[model samples]
Target: MSQSHTSQFALLTQRRFAPFFWTQFLGAGNDNLFKFAFTVLVTYQVQVAWLPPAVAGLAIGALFILPFLLFSATSGQLADKYDKARLIRFVKSLEIAIMAVAGIGFVTQQVAVLLLCVFLMGLHSTLFGPVKYAYLPQHLSERELTGGNGMVEMGTFVAILLGNVAGGLLIAMPGVGAQYVAWACFGLAVLGRVTAQRVPVSPATDPALQINWNPLSETLRNLRLARESVAVFRSILGISWMWFFGAVFLSQFPSFAKEVLHGNEQVASLLLVVFSVGIGIGSLLCETLSRRHVEIGLVPVGALGMSVFAIDLYFASRGLPQPAVSYTLGSFVAQPGHVRVLLDLLLLSLSAGLYSVPMYALIQMRAQASHRARIIAANNILNALFMIASAVLAGALLQAGFSVPQVFLVTGLLNALVGFYIFMLVPEYLLRFVALLVSRCIYRFKVHGDEHIPSHGAAVIAANHVSFVDAILLMAASPRPIVFIMDHRIFKIPVLGWLFKLARAIPIAPQKEDPATYERAFQEAQRVLREGDLLGIFPEGAITRDGTLQEFKGGLMKILQAQPAPVVPVALQNLWGSYFSRVEQGTAMVRPFRRGVFSRVGVVAGPAMPAETVSLDGLRERVGRLLAA
Candidate 1:
């Protein structure tokens, strides 16, 4: 309810978020702790005929993710049909039971029982995954969604890192390592259950919905529901691709540190620490970079960084001299070349954090509340599939005699291709990227009273246009998409025109000049408002030839009469003499660097006026006041 909280860390102090954060944090820590300890036990100390040491880690991982592929659909349905808080408590209770059995397996050294417990733990996670994502939207405002998700993501990775460290340390003790690990797992599970009991009540999104028990049918249905929103579905695919890209690096860390970097187990652990810390830092940075909104522009930036660093890592890993002795963590860090390798790994993961958090937040913001959990379930299914494919592909590459660094190169190149394909499919990402560049780089853009723009429903933004890039700047300031009504002539310009077309800006001409185009533009604008989307119009009819206010036109009045939506007055400041404006002899963009780069410019929005009360003069007066402010 405290949407005004500016810092993401503030959520950690609140009842609405704190208990749930700890509950999930402990669950993730416990999951990693038990699994890693069991892995070490089997791979190092105890050996089994059925599960060879070479394949023990792989087999355990496969079993753990198997439930996501099998039961995610049902779990999503349950999350939608029941109170998430109660479901979380129930899942934590199940963790306690599973950990109890795992304790017995550890004490008795029963490999089969431990493996069975692994599958059950996987089931527990599958059930909790939907509840975890669905609960946030219910409790947090849209302003807090990105920050909330970032905290959770950062916490999840940190917990995993700490859990793995604890597991590895506890499992290496003299004779009681397994017993210690058992007790630690049981304690963490109990703590998780206790925390879950304190989580605030989160009611079901679709309490009246019928339950779907069949996984295959329910999965197909969930996918269909996700496909209802192209943005949300593509976001799911984007997130899955990220997992695929990451799994390649994560699954190869041991081999990479040993074979490529010629380092010992400590060096591998050091790589994990760097990666986990980098991702945590990037996740926490999203709230600040996005200004507490779901800004998908960062996705392209992240994708680009991911590929660049991944490719660099390939080159960094090559041509190292073989050392007589395996390098320890300290010795590895002492080498300058190894530092580049670590830096590449760190930056790649940081980019991944940026890439993923927004898509998750976008899915939460855009998906229908009724089936949001089901869509997240679909995402989980896809993520599982992609990770599996990543493993298979990496195996195939290595089997064909590709070195670890070569595998990294191939994955990075694939990431670039995949990123290009996704961005082309969704031009909104590209539009936002351009908008971000224009606002952050071309000018030192600032926004005021942006919160006055409605977060949802239909509205019209009536602003006094000053430059060709006003729409792009407005796009950067807004949290939602706006369909701008622009001059038809402007659509003939080169790069900006293509971007405007991609943004689906409705091109209008004067009624006397082109009556049909004018009518069609107005019709499209009306339809956009009727469909509860934002519509942006210049309202002054054309950009001013001189650096002064132009008389407002009646187009806004016509739009209000037809759609009856509130109109928000906006003003563009300090851009009249800029490069894109008609500054020199009524010609625009003829002079380069007219205002120089990063020149001061601003967009200020006034409070919305009721549709019935709005008039041409009143709106113009409001925008004039905003411009002068």
Candidate 2:
């Protein structure tokens, strides 16, 4: 709720965020602690005919996810209908009760009861999932969404790592291991409840909504609600795909360490440590890379890196030297090829963190506010299904005599294909990717007065266009999407034209030259404004043939007369001589590398002028001042 913090770490000091952060951190840690300790207990100490050591982990995982399939739809509705803080406190209280029962099971070594506790804990997480995601949007501003999600994601992985370590150590005690595990789980549950109490009240988004008790119908309805926004629905699928990709690596780590790397259990733990740390680092970096906005450009970048590193991991481990004996953590690190293996895993997981955090932030930012929680619930259900499918696919691969490395290879290739498919379906991701590349690599692009761009509602951006890539750079500068009105001639260029088409940029010609195109462009611009979307226009009407300001045209004035909206004046500076600009004999792209790589360029926006008072000369003067500045 606090907007004063600039860095994500500053969030840890605030009451609004700190309490929720710790509550969820402790809950995640406890979940892993209880499950891992129980897993070790069954695999090493207790024996049951129904649950064999080889399948104990699988059985626990299945039971845990089963609740999500059955209850996520109901939990989503409850989250929407009740205050999230109240729901959080209630969930924490339920955790305490579940742990109390788990304590008894741990002490008595009742495998069935402990297994039942796993299902209960899964239920606990299911109830909390929708609330956890929906609560962030309620409290944090759009600028804070990415940072908040990053902190929560980083904290979660760290907690899971610590929980697994503590659980293994406590449950391996020479005597009374089970009792120690029981006490630890109970204490964590209590701590979580205490933290939950301090969380600031978060009001329900849809308090008056009636409850839908039936899971099957409600699940379908929730998904339909999510699909109302194509971008949001696809983002949910992207997040689910990330879970599927991650589930493969996580589930294979132990076996990969033992069979591929010839390492002991401690080595497997070391791999977990490396992967978790990588994810935490990457999660925290999102806020910095995105410049405090929800930037989805990083999604494609993340996907590319995930595939690259996963494929490299396969090659890195394909022909590893078989150890004469099992390797301990120390000796494993001492090996020649082991570093590459660990590095591959680390980078792969880091890419995963980058891939997922933006999708989560995007979903929060774009989903309909009233149905946000249900949408998140739909996401949970899909994530559960994907993880389950990952397990089945991985199991089948292994059964078909594929090595772990070969499985990684297949998954890596599959990731590339899936990413391509998703990007084609949602060109926004690819569009952002191009914007990110052009801004960060082709030029050292910077923005000033970016806050002047309205975060919501329809607004028009009036700027002096300098280069063919001006729209792309502007796309990088603004956090939200902008529909641009461009000269139709620019649409004839090969790659740039395709990109503009993908961005849905409306192209126009002079009324005398093409009356229909000119009229249609204005109609589309008005429709965009009516839909509360940002419309961008080059008020100069065309790129300046010389590296100087051109007189502002009346097209922007025409649009404003038709659809009243505030106009933000923007100037693109130091871009006239760049490769994309018309600097070489008054023709753009005639000569390459005119300014070399990383050419200094800037986009400056001034405060919005009310639509009623805006004029062509006044707007031109405003842009001129910004260009000089």
Candidate 3:
């Protein structure tokens, strides 16, 4: 499927891709919806029973996470051993059964039984986790991976918000009780099944391999596979850290709202809203920020802002006398000095958006083709472990009589520490920094109309590809990192693959080589524009062997017409014959670089042009002149 064929939701109405999106969307929705209802029920309606308030809180938290630790390993293996589409349908069917069981617990008002269901739901999610991440690479093109991940992330967040809002409102409604929640779950499950039916069948990548029934062994196996590539492992670490960071903050929010801001649920929720919207904005900006390929440069930018706001929040809460605990949104809004609290929430979330989107894209790009889902499962297992640890660490602070504000300060400090720890271990961030350092330290490089690249929206970037190092150079040189549309074959090239993986290039090929891809790529490009990203494409389709630009292809015309974003014409010169570029035509062609030395490189951005002017000949002529200059 080409971009034009699957550009729209209607045109993309295919079986392989659509079902997984719906399955994940509905799953996210149900997960949050139920959690919201459960939290409200446990906190407000249920009487104190087998445990103390704090104990119950801890137990509930344990219940929510236990499934991931126990089942994720098995789940990851399952994805590798079976057809993903059929597996998804099976999972949806299981959801229907789980809903029925949940209905009984809700109606009976049995806390233990309800707790069982929470664990069960988590178990369901655990099983689906690996399948969820792995299934996409099978379905979408490399060009579409980041955009598709962005859509899935965006959709998941929106669905989560709606689910949480609905759960809270529904649990309090007359006549519905928990039964209504169960019914909602059932309805969504049915819808998911319908979508799954439309999903194209994805065959098992390794069905012939013997199934590993042992969770511990299988879990280790998956991690070993992921670690085969250093960048892949680092990407998994980045993802795991997100779960850790998320668990730390989200766990503390209620306490922070109650003790620090002295505001009600509404105000606290307002904090959540700002963060969610921020992330949504960031995820959408990936296409624009990344320039339509795998641009992880924003990760550093996101991390920087996250730390700054965390520090600002430390000051924001100072000098304000704590108000009596209130759960009303209005009461908190009326309080003096609560504005900083909201801003803190927004900043944390906005920066989080910058941090996470690229991590997901990186993982998707780097994981091995055959075991992507299992690798994702390994990631989930680590995420569960880190989140559980995050909860315990956060809980220890709360138990030690530390106020929520104090906890925020400590976690903020820890976030900065952990982020630095990971960056030190991986050095992609450091590598990017070094790349920029060398650029600034050694070469006087300049990029024009990068603002034309769109600061907050999506745009098309047509560049002339002359070397294999184009992605690394573009990512390093551009004011905002751009995502490059690339050749699928490049994804398998060793260390280059890691570099490509870190940058998040979307690898593509002609339909003759890969018939069922790039449809999603176009859809993802549209998604980036919607989210405000600068999508970079090589209209010539691949690097020019002759060191000359080739004619543009058909997809750009369709993409530009559909998206209608500004087009940036990028040119590269003197990158040829460098260490990362093509020097010879043999297997031992690549040579190592000198330590701390720099390659002479040049990148220039021409003025922004309309999509109409970004046609095959026009873009080529403009970039040709720029490259020549």
Candidate 4:
């Protein structure tokens, strides 16, 4: 598993990239660890205070979240308007200031000041979110985005769990004290700042970007851009939903550990440790499961696990005795009966991890390049919205007299139902679901030399577009997902558009009617390859009306000039005979012999050719020959 994770880690260890990954990781770690420390101190250690533990818990959570609502707008704009590396350095420096205050508060036992620091850190993180997400497309390719985000998420949760354990252990230390724990956080903050200095310069995407001073209006503008594509918007919703689940589950750990498992806060921290580790594990698994692309086929699968296990957790805890809570980890192990709680914890975190990583990748892959940062800002806004709602929902449920187990049961069942309903309505998840399913369960894919397609970054796939199903078929056929240059009309289809937008397929039109479309398509094609995807284009401009291939258009020439990614010409022979076969077949059933279920979906790839060989007529002639052969 470590070896499998090496490529993902390369993004971190490599000098050009590692600093940003660590900067973001350390910042998140510091944020959660401090919040955990404050929450633990108020809820357990002090036991004397001005307010009840529940009120303090809610206030602490609120303080961290309020910053996202108030400061994300400014931070997101700053990220777009300046060099991200510098902005990150500035943020880390701010952390040093916040941590210094936190250390003073911890030693003085000033809970209000600690909560204030939590709010400040939340504000710091809000500013970092856009920078964190937007920085990647500048450095990594489309292929690397999914894997990269997986590593980020995995690292984050692992850090979170470690910080939780560290906070509890440090405060309870016999010789050491809470002040020392705060100093250790401050030390890590300094380490993060040093790493930030090493991050490569990512120049401003919009140096002239106007700062929207009003958080509400700016947040609204950002969401409007995100909603331009239903698929992109849906991805945002999916991500926000995970945060919703996370906030609820994370907030309930204390009650869950006490009344249900009959274990103390230490066991509570252990449950969190198990869950966070599971999240990191599942996140890393997405790279292998998705084959290193932003394949969101796993989102619904994650949702399934969330709902299934939640229900089972409810059942698992039904009859068990409510043993007295114990602070020592050994007590739960001694009882040997609360193992089910442990399983539920691990499964819930694993599901949450799987749900999140792909959604992050999808937003990056699909958003307009000029406004990608803003789209991520919109995502943060929705995430904030979801998290707030989760808190409200949990409070309402509990106020209505639902037990912790019952709430778990309900949320879990709702997760499954919601997931199934969404997949059924969209069908893209199910389509990719089927594509991946048939891919793994039925036919094994055999790619001879994927290296022929650019290994480190992006490449162009110039194929004779033969049918309406050509792009999706090629998507299913290739080992790597391809960003196709498709017609504007096809992108409007119901189910197909859902996935195309998700795949970030560029749309083109005639230069006369829509110069904007033509210019945008060429620009987007270049961006797609530059972003590290295989840019597939149909030089024919349209599917063949006659059986013979048409003349290759100048679009290919234009794309070659824009970026000059190596071109791999592809040919499709017998694909027109099946249901999708444009060769005018009987329904899907009538087309087959050797071509039964899939028929022979023949696709041939020629050796890499020079961009100099990329002439309109010459490339057309070669593709025509390959089609005939």
The per-model lDDT (C-alpha) reads: 0.92, 0.93, 0.72, 0.76
Please give, for residues 406-510, the per-residue lDDT of candidate 1 as tens digits.
Answer: 999999999999999999998999898898888888888788888888878999988888889989989988887899999999999999999999999999999
True-structure lDDT of candidate 4: 0.76
lDDT, model 1:
0.92
Top lDDT prediction, candidate number: 2
Give per-model TM-scores: 0.98, 0.98, 0.71, 0.77
Tens digit per residue, CA lDDT, model 2, 1-629:
11344698988899989999999999999999999999999999999999999999999999999999999999999999999999999999999999999999999999999989999999999999999999998888888899999999999999999999999999999788999999999999999999999999998889999999999999999999999888899999999999999999999999998998999999999989999998998899899888788999999999999999999999999778887999998999999889999899899989998999999999999988898999999999999999999999999999999999999999999999999999999999999999989988888878888888887899998888889999998998887899999999889999999999999999999999999999999999999999999999998888999888899888888888999999999989999888888876788887678777788899999999999999998988999999999
Better of 1 and 3 by lDDT: 1
Q: 288-357, model 3: which lDDT tens digit per residue?
A: 5554445566677677667777767778887777655564777666665777767777777778777887
lDDT of 2: 0.93
Q: In model 4, what lDDT does residue 52 have?
A: 74
Q: In each prediction, how many residue pairs overlap at the backbone (N, C-alpha, C within less than 3 A)?
A: 0, 0, 25, 3
* Residue pairs with backbone overlap in model 2: none
- RMSD of every prediction: 1.6, 1.7, 13.2, 6.8
Candidate 4 per-residue C-alpha lDDT over 314-364 given as tens digits, one digit per residue, 9 for 90 to 100: 888787776444546887866545677678778877888887888788778
In candidate 3, stretches whose alpha carbon ends up further than 4 angstroms from where it belongs are 1-16, 51-53, 321-328, 334-336, 433-629
**lDDT at 471, model 2:** 97
Q: Report how far residue 407 has shifted in candidate 2, in Å.
A: 0.7
